[model samples]
Structures are given as C-alpha cells and as structure tokens.
Target: MNPFYFVFGRSANMVLILIFFFCPVSPSYGYDPLDPKGNITIKWDLLQSNSDTNDVKVSLLNFQLYRHIEQPGWKLGWEWLGKEVIWSIQGAEATEQGNCSRFKGGQLPHCCENKPLIVDLLPGAPYNIQTSNCCKGGVLSSMIQDPTKYAAVFQMNIRAGGAADSDFDMPQNFSLGVPGYTCAKPVQVAPSKYSSDGGRRWTQALGTWNVTCIYSQYQASTSPKCCVSLSAFYNDSIVHCPKCSCSCQGLPGSKCVKFGETPSLLQQVKDPNQEPPSIVRCTQHMCPIRVHWHVKQSYKEYWRVKITVNNLNILKNYSGWNLVALHPNLKSLTQVFSFNYHPLNQYGHINDSGMFWGVEYYNDMLLQEGEVGNVQSEMLLHKDEGIFSFREGWVFPRRILFNGDECVMPPPDDYPRLPKNTARAASFTLSIIFSPLFMLLIIFAC
Candidate 1:
C-alpha cells in the first residue's frame, strides 16, 4: 500500500510541474469581479455665502472622468463615465431675490434630499472624475473660487461579472460647488435738510431736497430779514416797540424784516454815435501817430496803432486804411480808433490833444542784416509816401518805401490793381520800419 501511494504522489507532482512550465503564467495581478447589485453613495457639502446652509443650489456641467492604466505605463485615459452617474441632490428652494428654488425645473434640488447618480468604471482601472459648470455660460463658473481643484472629487464604480473587487474602489467625490454671486439689493439714502453740513444729506425722501427758507440779509422793505431777525420772528411774530405806539415786528427796531422787495435788474446803456468804425488812410497829418510793436514767426516784426473810433467812422473808411499787423485768426487784436483822448502815450511819446486815429499794415516787415526795424524818433516827411489808406471799400498802397538795401517789395505782378486807382511807383523813403530782429529776440526769450 505504501509503494502504490508513493507512485500516485510522484505522478501528481510531475503533472503539476508540466502544467506550470507549459502555461507560463504572465506577471499580472487579478482583481475580483464587482458586485452587480452594489450602489455607490456620494455626498457633497452645498456651497453657501456664510455657513453650511443647504438653501443654495449648485450643479455640475461638462462632468468627465479619467482612468489610470498600469499596462500602458500608468497613462491617463478619458472616460465618459459621467453619463453612467445620476444626480442625488437636486438643490435648495429659492426664497431670496435671485435665489434658486426646487419648485423650478431648472433649480438644483437639495443634497441627500435628492437622488444621486451612479458612475460606471472599467474593472481594475484606477480612475478619477472631474466636473465643471464653466460650459453653462453663467456667473457660476467665473465666480467659483478655485473651481479646477474642487472638480476633482467625482467617483465611479465598476461591475465586473458578479463578484466584488477590492481593487475597484470608487473615485473620490468632488464638486464644482455653487458660487455665491447674487447681488444684494441697493438701499438709497435721501437728502436731509437737518444734516450736519449746510447742504442736505440723504434721507427717506429719496434724492430730492426739502426746500426750507434760509433767511439772509435784508435789502429793502420787501427783502428777507437777516437770519437772527428771521429766527426771532419765527419764534414770535409780535414784539413791543420802545418809541412808537405801533409794535415793531419781532425784536423792536431790528433792521431785519420777514420779507422785502426783490433786487432790481441792471440797466443797459446806449450811445447815439455808435456807428461801426471804418478803416482810414494814414494821412500826412497822421504821420507821427503812436505805434505798438509785436513779433511774428519766421523772424518778422509787426506794428499797429491803438485807438477807438465810432462805428460809423469805421464803416465810412472801411477801405482806406489797412489793419496790417493783426493776425487773421486773432480778430480781437485789431486796433480801433476813438474820438476820446487816451491817457497812455504811444511807445512813451505824448500825443497832441485832438481826435486821433491810427493806421496799421496788413503784412509783417522782414528784416535783413545790419537793418534796424524800430525807430527811436519819428521819421522826416517825404513826397509820395507809401501810405496805406482805405476808401470806398478799397485798400490802396499809395507808394512803396524803399531804403538803400533790397527793400524786398511785394512782387509787382502779385499786386492787386483797384478798378479806379493806378499802382504807385516804388519810392525811396526813411520811415520807422519794423525789424525781424525784434521777432528773433522774442522767440529766444520765450
């Protein structure tokens, strides 16, 4: 019996060795099958403004899961495992303004109060799930703090055949929690007359101000009384008078009165000789008139006469004198003549007692080397003087004053010819010429 037992044992051992060698078991671990009837329970804390109140509604969108596989060197593989899960917590009721409610189909039902969704996973595969409300295109996604980290907690369960596998545990539960972005209702404060400052402050009367009489100084019998007097009158309308039998209103003999007449409007003045002033030619009599100097761009100097004249004179002599130095853009700079005597002298020179007028040139005078533009004293009289005069709506340059140097006169062809006046010949003359050197001095100083 011992020999037969030994033979049987040896045969059995040989058969086992053959099986091990021929089968060549792969280097792998086996996972027990999952229970088909098992359910995964998931719970998440509802997001709230201040505390863990389940009154706020929150939801997840674009939910997804990934599985980590060892065979492929622990690479991450995406799985649409969210479709397998069902929601458990619908959300809380909406009572406050902009709050979400469970009665509304779109509202999120409360957690634990609502059913949770189950996610399915592949057997033996390590998996993770994530959810995002970003695709919902609302304030929820942007307002959530650290949404990416919060989304990493969704879990998944797998059913492999019928048995449960210890290796097939559910992924950690996560959430893209609801964001507290509801705006609070704005409260408005109305303006109050009793505020600390003199101005009104906001009160229950909205933004409108309640007008109240703020007594000021009195001007006439109808003017409002002074604040002190008004205060006395407000307290007591009647008071005893010291001298007269008739009682003086509140605080006897007080200059202040309850009301007074309104101030009168200012009166407007008019002048009879207010004709539009006209431009007149600089006559020989007006030769020594006062001149004011100014500078211009491109190294040029300008001169003008300052005077005020009646508007009628300006209209009558519109074409006689050329208001040269005034800039076209600076109309205010134009000189006007007047009949009244001016206290200030022209360039510090006293003027003769008479109704004086001024004439100006239209263009700036250019300066050359060794040329002095300003004259300390008036120039000597000359024949055929190049004078600018206005007449019958026409401007005439009677003569061109030329010095020894190339006078740089305006091109003869460019000169406009008056219908009834002939172009005067250029003449040599001495006059107070404007110099461009002065312009350079002004430019450098500035």
Candidate 2:
C-alpha cells in the first residue's frame, strides 16, 4: 500500500474503534406519548399446558408478543435522545435465521424478525425499539424435542424446592413471543377488507393480506385502511397496508412466505337459548362503535350485535359509519339486520372474503355517546372447523372508527355455545402430571 493511503486507512480504523468504545447502542423503547391522534394499548394473557415434571408448554391468549434483533457487533452511529442510535442488546441474545447473514453462517443463533412487525408496533414508534411485553424466542426445537435437553437447558439453572430445601417464590410476568429456530415472523392483519366493485363484491386475492412483525405502519392509513380501487384516495382512516405495499417475510433469501393465514381466535358473545337475547360486553376503548355482541337464537347459526358510542368527545356524529364484523370461523353470512332504533339504516351485506360490512342507511345516521344501538347479522358455520378446531370460534378484525381512529377491542370471551352436535376439543390436554414442587421454577421455565 502507498505510505499515505496506508496511514489514512489505519487512522480510520482507529476512529471506528474509538467510536465503538465511547458510544453505546440505542434501541427503540415505547411509543411517543405526545402523538396528537390518541394512544392505544396491546393486550395478552399467558396460557400454559403442563405434561410432566419435565414438560411444560407455553402459548398466548389475546395479546401478541414479538421479538426484534439488534445488529451484531459495534457500528458507527449518531446520538439521539442522549444515546447512540445503533442496535444493541443486553442479557442473552437469541440468534435468528436469515437475520442479515448468508447461507451457511447466520443460522438462527436463535429467535426474531425478517422485517418490522406490523406497520410499526405503535403508529408513530420507530424501528429497532426494545419491545417489552416480550419473553423468550426462537423455536425451542432441541428443548421441545428432547425431554433430557429440555430439563438440562431450562431446568438446570432452576432449583426446584423440596420439603427439606428452601422454597423459591419468584414473581414473574409471563409473556409470549415466537421462537427463533421457527423464525415465525410476526403477522399483521389488513386493517379493513377491500372491494374493487364498490362494496358490491370482493375477492380475497384483491383485498387484505398479511405482513411480517416489523412491517412499516401504513403512511396513508394508520389502522388497516382499504381502498376500493387504485384511483381512490385513502384517508388517515384505518391502519392498513395498501395492496401495492403489502410484503411477505423470507424475502431476503427469496423464500416464499405464504399468505391467507387463518388464525383461530376465541369469540366474545352470549347464549342464544335464553328467552331474551343475552348481553355481551365491550371490555376496551372501542370508541365510535363500542359494541357488545348478543345471541338472538340458540341455533348457533344466528347472532345479534349491539353497537354504541361510549365517549361523546371521541365520537360525535358517525353518520356514514360502516360496521364490519370479522370472524375467521364464519363460513358464510346470510343476512344482516338493522339497529332497533333506526331499523332500516343498519343493514349490510357480506363480501367474498367472509367479511360482513353494512353501510348505515339513514342519511343523518348518528350514534351519540352513552347511547346504545345495534345491528344484527346471520352467519353459517363449518361445524367441524369453527367449533371444535379454533379456540373461541371468532377472530374479528381490529375495529376502525368512521373518523379513521383505530379502536382496540377486548379479547374474545363471552362466545356463543358450540352447535349442539359438536363439543370442544380436548386435543391439547395431556396425561402426565408433575408435582406442585416443580412449579417453583415457573419464572425460569420461560
């Protein structure tokens, strides 16, 4: 090398090293508290299945858990919010498959993403943030496969209490996240279903789709927005990924990530057998259209939904609101009923994708806060698929307000009973039982 060039290169290397030492990495943390629109919370619960002293399986309830990885090694970055704007991690790190490396090398050290999960965790949150509400990730293939290894890796450090030994009472916050070896990238649902023929017809291939965990927030519509056609403009109405922008994971290596994921979720509804329809609850801040579902009949085929406006300030006059109901288990929607007060105004029809959305008919249709109104719809079920297969028999889309606000609904709980012929599955139930003594390491089991 030329003397001058060699000296410059060495100096550059030194500067980089110095930068690494003096500067620390920065990862995103929480959403911006000052966003003008409004703030929403994500909810979830932990579900565990116990098998034996050596085996325990974990899953999630309503809320979702996601993982993001920091770029390995030090890199040059600028200071933002008093911390260097570079990816970094503490504690132990799970290596992920296809997390920015080649064919043979970066085989998932264990757990995390291909792209940003969902438009963004929060509407305005940045990429590379510390996603709390997260626990272990990466497919525990070895651990899940071998009881011996499972005991070794997970229980080795955990000291189960015995009658003679000290008991360990550790308070832990149980959470959920995809395992890495599985590299199951996060899934984001389309905000609202789309129809090209002016809500008259819809094709699954034409409308909604899925995306990875760290997907970018829809710039035009924050809460799953939809457009009728390419020419139609989108309002800041729903958080959605436009048809043109939807992406698939496993793209780096050019692998195919299939779409049309039918996620089974529980439903929140009441019984149909009662004389008067049973009342369901709206557990969250589903403002403009705070809804409580009811079962009008016991046939397991038909149900009623009562829609309301909880906050007056948040929802004033929702004149042209189109109520949409999504249930992954629904096979077909035969009819949609009108609200009790304005009977004619609340009728809608089902589209091709099994999404039922009805336009409010009343010209000046409005739902005032503290006022409860309802729209009912009829549905047919695939007896085997809807009742016995999924958790709660429903998986509705995240609601959106007429004014384009995203409404967070509570997890499904109050659901209609399974059709008389079928019963809930005990498939997940296992036989082996473990002593309560081993429960001491519940925290470490994560």
Best by lDDT: 2
Q: Tell me how candidate 1 scores on lDDT.
A: 0.21
Tens digits of per-residue lDDT for model 2 on 1-446? 69999999999999999999888452122221112211111211111212211111111211111111111111111111211111223222323222433224443222223221111122223334323322222111111112221110110011121122232222122112321111122223443333668989863321111211211223322332121110001111222222222122333322221223221211334222112111112212212234333322323434333233332222223333333333433334444444211111112442212222334353224443333443334433333333433224342333322223233443334223243332223332221234344565685686
lDDT of 1 by residue, 1-446 (tens): 69999999999999999999998653221110111111111222222222111111222221111101011011111122221112221221111112223234663422211113222222332222223221111111100112252211222221222233322212232211211111112122342222445556632211221111111111111211101000011122211111211112343342211122221211224222232221212221111111221111111122332221111111122211111121121221222322111121222332211111122242112111112322211111111123322222112121111110001122233333224332332122111233466677899999
- Could you report the Cα RMSD, in angstroms, for every candidate shown? 44.2, 32.4
C-alpha lDDT of residue 390 in model 1 = 23
Q: What is the TM-score of each candidate against the true structure?
A: 0.13, 0.25
Clash totals for all candidate models: 58, 38
Alpha carbon deviation, residue 206, candidate 2 (Å): 33
Question: What is candidate 2's CA lDDT for residue 426?
Answer: 34
Regions of candidate 2 where Cα sits further than 4 Å from its true position: 1-288, 300-311, 339-364, 370-405, 412-446
